[model samples]
Target: MHPGVKTKEPDKMSPPEKMFPVLLQKNYVPQGEYEIVGYLKEAVKVKNAVGQMVIVEPEEFVKGEMKPHESPGVGFGPMEMKDGRKVNAKIWAGTTIKVPVAEAKYVVAKKIAERADDIAA
Candidate 1:
């Protein structure tokens, strides 16, 4: 600890990167809702499976390379919202997040959206 040295802080209020709704498979651990906030610039470790470990590298954290529109995702643990305090989520692979737009749901959503058009007419 150096009294003369000062530390820079992350821009907590900075707008989040472009995000897309993603599905965290119920089968995966620490299941919940998550979004494709953006590709990970730094390498991170995740639980690929029980008793298994996988390191998601920066190069591997890509979008569209794995079948189009679908990108890998990560799960976060609890987080604190208070200011002046720093906290990082206890992250895990959480059964691996295969984040991509579900086409089936898109189809349903399209139909529902059409109703709005009908009402406008």
Candidate 2:
């Protein structure tokens, strides 16, 4: 083989191609099938089973379910509305949630906090 010339056979692919794992955000739920609607350097637009197009953080994987870790920490603060004063609070990963994915329609990639009652107990 010539120094400048390259001659290497490509590897054979199995029946089904392998998919890479997708990196998820703190509050993002990685589950179910996702359609590749768009692509970006940082993330890709994917449609979940609900037909909702959302941005999926780029990491790896094509269609699959994944359980992400808890979200970031958040503190509660006081806030007043026009109606009256209320005990508004900031929220972080207060609980563990299971996100299910059906088809490539919509994506459920968001962090959520557990209920106050659940945490209180």
Candidate 3:
């Protein structure tokens, strides 16, 4: 250690990449009551049954090439304010989140059944 040298300040650290859990069942889905606790650049985070968290983009979750029946969804709905306008939730860069999945109530079942019927047809 040099006696006359001044100590340098430590650099600030950036946040780690967030991750969410993957629910791999047709009956699992995100509900419409959840809120986005954090925002990421084109990504969202969620926890799975095994306690593993993962990150995903809005397009990957909402409108990507991935089939809705195959991947999980972020359980959130359009948010309406007192101004009579609805706000759609989004994930931006550096957002932390906890995505929840609900039991596929009916629509998912109908879609699966419809697909099966289409195959038969």
Candidate 4:
């Protein structure tokens, strides 16, 4: 073959597998099927069986229930109205809560996944 001439040959191997471990953020962790919806440089978007989307790391998997972490705080509402005039009202006490967070786990890929690049999470 001449230096300027080139021959066409099939690639030795296909595209490298993009195996990723997904993390699910749910109130309760039930062993079920999960799918990736979107992808990011550092994170991935995953869709659960219930149609809930969660963003997680690219190379990590989290499956379990969330842990409760509560911090008590006082809350006050808007002022009271009296006779079409703004007046001071008694300070109302209340509590606000936030959702729990689950720990992230690293899952190792045992085999090459098909169409793994398509999945975000």
Q: Would you estimate the TM-scores of all the predictions?
A: 0.17, 0.16, 0.20, 0.18
lDDT of 3 by residue, 89-110 (tens): 4323222233433322232344
Clashes per prediction?
1, 14, 15, 0
Alpha-carbon shift of residue 56 in model 3 (angstroms): 30
Question: Scored by CA lDDT, what does every candidate get?
Answer: 0.37, 0.34, 0.37, 0.32
The CA lDDT at 57 in model 4 is 56
Number of backbone clashes in candidate 3: 15
Best first by lDDT, ranked:
3, 1, 2, 4
TM-score of 4: 0.18
Q: Return the lDDT, model 3, position 27.
A: 30
For 1-121, candidate 1 gives per-residue lDDT tens digits of 6999989988879763332333222222222333332232345678865867678764444542211222456435446677755454432321223322353244225442111112334
| Tens digits of lDDT, candidate 4, 54-93 | 8765643232322222334533223447567544222211
Estimate candidate 4's alpha-carbon lDDT, on a 0 to 1 scale: 0.32
Score candidate 2 by lDDT: 0.34
